[model samples]
Structures are given as C-alpha cells and as structure tokens.
Target: MSDPLFEEDEVPTWIFTFADLMSLLLVFFILMYSLSKMTETTLESALSSIQIALSSNGANINQSPRFYSGGGSKLIAPETPQLADTQDLTFSEEPIDTEEREQVNEIANDIANKMVSSNLSNAVSVFEDGEKITIRVDGQTLFESGEAQLSYEAEFIFNKLIDIFNRYPEYSISIQGHTDNIPINTVRYPSNWELSAIRATTALRYFLEAGFRPERMTATGYADSIPLVRNDSPENRAINRRAEFVLQKDPDLQKLYGK
Candidate 1:
C-alpha cells in the first residue's frame, strides 16, 4: 500500500516538440516565397541588359560605328555598314588602292619566279597590275593553227599549272578563250565560237578533274574579239588567238562598296 500524497505519474514532452516542428515548417515556406520574388527581379535585370544591346539610341548609332575588336561593337565617331542586319551583318569598307596593288604585284613576281625555276617561262606569262593577276597562255603554244585541240606540249604545261594552283586554294580563276577573225567549219566542231567555247570548257574540265573546286573556276569564250594585237598581219593574228587565265577579286568585297 502506497501513501496517497506520495503517488507519482509521468507526462509526455512530445506534444511541445510537435508544435516547434510545425513552426519551423511555416518559416521555411515564407523564406521560399521571398526567394522566388527575388529570382524574378534578377531575371528581369538580365533581360534588360540584352535589350539594351539590341536597341540603342539613334544619335549614338549614327555618330558611332560598331568596330569589333573582340567581336564587340566598339564605336568610333563615324562608322557605317553597306548591309547590316541581325542575320547578315556587313560593314562598309574603303577600297584598297595603291597598297593592295603593290602587294598583289609582289605575289605575282614571286609566282613568276617559281614558274621560271620550273622552266615554264616561255608558254605561260604571269603578271599582276592594278586590278588583277593575269596568266596569258599563247595559242601558238597551247594549240595548232586554226585548231582548238590541245597540242601534246600543252599537257605538260597543264600539269605544271595544276601543281601551282593546288598550292593556293584560296584564289578564284577564270579561263578565257580568244580567237582571230579566221573562221573555221570542221566536222567535229562548227564555227570559231564553238571552237573557243569548247577549248575553254575543256580547260575548265581539266581543272575540275584535277581536284579544283568548281565554284572557284569559270570558263568564258571570246571569239575573234578582245584582241591584244591589231589582228592585221599574220603575227598579230597569231597573237590575238590566245587563252588567258585571270584571277578575280573576292566577292565579299562588294559589301565594302555599299552597292
């Protein structure tokens, strides 16, 4: 038997622990909501930065141009583009005058020296002027008189040319065929026009087969026209009937002209 005043009992403290846990959960949700609002503000600031880059003030846009040093629009006092858009951005550029001409002349001289070393100076002439690099192939060397067919010696010349052209893959070449006033009507080919066109086409085909890019090569026929000589005498007529290989300028350069 126990005394009534000495009887004891235990009460659980777990109920208070449960209430503290619920309070912590409520605090967590409130913190999360505040962070979400801050995230939206940060996103808006980032978008504003991009928008500023796209839409600039009209006054600064005109007075300054976008010169990209590190692919960034570094504006100067004056800048313009011949064609400028989001997809295709082109900048207006100045023409390369005397300096560019000198450089091309130097390159042509070097090429001529190389051909000289290879012992190909007679049939082929390589030179550069103000506008283009010219390669003049004499008809006397490439073909027989009044004929479009390539001579046996022309094959050797063509092989040497292939070696030279393969090295500089960046250049674009155009082969032009010219003839004298002497007309031709053969079974295989009819008329001087057809003969010249065929010869140019044949030369172009050789270039393509020898691993040249088709886009970089062009063949043109000029029959009894565009004569270097007066075509009056036999010697002049012989000189007039010739083939020329011309190196054209880069097409992208048009963007500089703004036309």
Candidate 2:
C-alpha cells in the first residue's frame, strides 16, 4: 500500500500544461481584438507624436508611417491637408463712376499725346483710375540722385503740365514725391522724408510761380512707403523713385479757378 502523503500529492501533469496553453490563447485573442479596434485617428495621432519625437532627436525621417491590422492588412497614414492658395483667388475692387472715368481717360489721353509730342513719353506715364488721373514722372528725369533741385528737363515738363492745368481748372492737383529704400543723410536732407518733401515743395513752387492757385494744390512726401512694385531689383527701385501729379475733380476748386 502507498503512503497517505504520496497519495494526496499525486496530480495530472498534463492538466497543468493544458491550463497554461489556454491562458496563452486567451491573452493572444485579447491582443488581436484590441489591435483590430484601433481607429485611423488614433493611429494617425500616434504617428504624429512619433514624428515629433524623431524630429526633436534630429532624425531625418520623411516617409509616412504604416500600421498593420489583426488581419495582416497594411494601413498607411493620411497625408496632411493642403491650404488654399490666396494668390489664385480673385478680389472685387471699388466700383468706378462711368462719366468720371471717361473724363479722366480723356485727360490721360491728352497728356499721353502731349508727352509723345514733347519727346518726354519715356520719362512719364499717365494712369486713370475712377475719378482721378495720375501723371507719374521718373525721378531721375527731373532731378539728380539725392538732390531736391529740379533739372532743366523738369522745367520743360512743368511748363507742359502747367499748360494742361490751365485748361483743367475743374481739377485739383496733388504733388506726391516717392523715393527708393536707400538711406540718405545730409545737412539739407536728414532722411528720405526731408528729401521727398523738399522735392514735392519744389515742384509746388514751380506751379505756384506759373500762376496756378496755391489753394488748389497740395504737396506730400511718401518716402519708400508706397511702391509700384517690389523694390528687389534696380529697375524696380528706379520705378519706385518717382513724382506723381494726381488730379482729381474738385467742385470748389472749379469755382476758385473760374471753371
């Protein structure tokens, strides 16, 4: 007969092995189910976090992340959404008065014809916008570099402009001076502002001496503030350095000039 202790200790080794195998199977199934339930958003978030971490570590990783599902299917991360290009979009401008625009165009045409006849076409340009007309003169054509004094060519241009002003007593003139981004410092012109202001005033004085009503004119200086184009090149900078004679219809001035 067997001892009582040995008999009590006796057990099936196979049963323990079977229980261990079942436990492993249960854990494997749970892991598979969890992996299958993972959403695209959750995976994408995890990928982004990983990318940020890699980037912080100075790792150059350009490839997008890919995940595997329980069914052995590959899931690639979604690409970032691109922003809309504002440059391609169209914007509406202020509506222009038809009759006023026509008048301004007529004045522009007259100026253009005069410029061609005077051989000053290349030095000047005329633009008509809404109720106003602009006669833009290249700065180099009127004055030397960094100088406010008018050149001989400026006198000729001013004479032609005065003739036009005599005819258009209904319009008010605004002389605006512009400059390039280059800095200037001198006893006469402390900065571009002074230079520009003096240049505008000089032109105004010429107009005043030509018997134009001073009340109908103004002088302004905008030093490298308003530019026609990007001041990145020599040509563009030259274009930006200009003086503009802006004419607008002024009813009060019309009466003042006996229009």
Candidate 3:
C-alpha cells in the first residue's frame, strides 16, 4: 500500500550510516597523508614533544574552552631547559678499543722483558690499563735523594726507551713525577712541587734532546697528591716516589679502526 504522494526512489536508513563511516575514513587518510609529508626532523621533534608531555607531571589539560575555541587541537608540551651551545657536555675520556688495548699490552710486555734482560727489573715496572701503558721507574734508580740529576744507569735506560719511542712515533707520551709525603725545602727546590716538576722536566728534556716531537710529549708532577701507598713505611714511601711514562691512545684512530 504505497502512498501516491511518496517518491519511488526514497533513500534507505543505512545510507546515512555509510556516509558517516566514509567521512571518518576520509579524515583518517588525510591525517596520515599530512604526517607522511612532514620532514624527518619535524616528525622526530613532534614525537619527542609528545613523549615529554606524557612523562611530565606539569601538563595541564584543564584549561578553559577558550584555549581551543579556534577549531584547532592543542598539544601541551612543556619546554625543557637545554644546555648552552658553548657548554661542553662531553668532558669524559673515550673508552679504549680492543685493538688499542692489545697494542698497549704488547708494548708493556716488551718493555717488561727489556727491563728484565738488562737486569733493571727491580728499578722499573710496566703496567697497562685499558686506555694506556704506564712504565714506572723507581726514583732512586734515576735520582739520588733530594737530587734531580739523572744517574749513569738512568741515562742508559732512557736511551733504550728512546729507541722504543722511535719505533712508535705516533703515540702521545706523558711523563709524570711523583714524590713521597716527606716535606722538603731546599735552596733549589722550595717545595715538593718544585722538586717533582723539575724531575718531570728533566725526564722530558731527555726525550726532546733525543729528537722526539715536542708536540707529542707532556710533563707533569703529582707532588705526593697521587701516591701508590699510604707512605706509612720506608718501603711504601720508596714505592710512592717514582717517575711514570704513560702512552695515550688516539681517539679518532680508535674509532676508525672499530673498537
């Protein structure tokens, strides 16, 4: 019983639901396309902002309706304080690579063998940390008590060491002088600092005179600030008073070689 006034091609109730679904799908595709068009940096920034916003407790979503009255959504992201460009955030030393560590250990073992062969094992010792190789020589072997002059045996040892340095000219070397806790006030050395510095300089000068590159070498003094023992006994004090040679690894080379 169709009414004569009714149109034959009337719209179905399902049409309205279908139209709503299509509209939602279209909006979703538009959003996807917009996100795809964003640059990588912008995308990363947006993601970082979202992460920060989610993690922070300061986010305020209870703002007045006037905040989003302009038909645009609000993304509340609290600005984090950033370090200044001039501030150096990387102040720590780089880790040593396996190849560099092996190289350092090889050098240390070779030097130890040389000292043993020359019957100077008691005077000198070799150790390797992951980053560097340290060759420590007893102060008495190189200098008399309260004196900075190198002995005849010390000169021979330095010559041999210079030969080793020549084979590896690329290595950067540091010579450090350390002293026992005993205080000294001499006419030449007013304090332990002066004595320690002079001793380090004396060792550095020998290398420089042997034609080692000035730029590749450094000299420093610890002045009882870095001691091997507590200086509570004569044996411990003797161990504390020594000269050290440390060979540093090049950071760039380690990276290039894949540590």
Ranking by TM-score: 2, 3, 1
Q: Model 1 compared with the native: what TM-score? A: 0.57
For each candidate in the order shown, give its overall lDDT on alpha carbons.
Answer: 0.65, 0.76, 0.72
lDDT of 2: 0.76
> What are the candidates' C-alpha RMSDs?
27.7, 23.9, 26.0
lDDT of 3 at 237: 70
Best by lDDT: 2
Query: lDDT by residue for model 2 over 64-168, one digit each (tens)?
Result: 233322222333222222322433212214566787678778888998899999999999988776677889999988988878889999999999999988889
lDDT by residue (65-133, candidate 1, tens digit) is 122212222221212212214222111244558876786677678778877887878767886655567
Q: Clashes in model 3: which pairs? A: none
The CA lDDT at 259 in model 3 is: 39
Better of 2 and 3 by lDDT: 2
How high is the lDDT of residue 37 in model 3? 94
Best by TM-score: 2
Tens-digit per-residue lDDT, 1-259, candidate 3? 8798885887899999999999999999999999889986666556555533432112322222223221123333322223223212112256767887788778878888988998889888888776677888988789877778899978988987897777666667899998876555557777679889999999999999989878788999878777676666557678878998987665553454453
lDDT of 1 at 137: 82
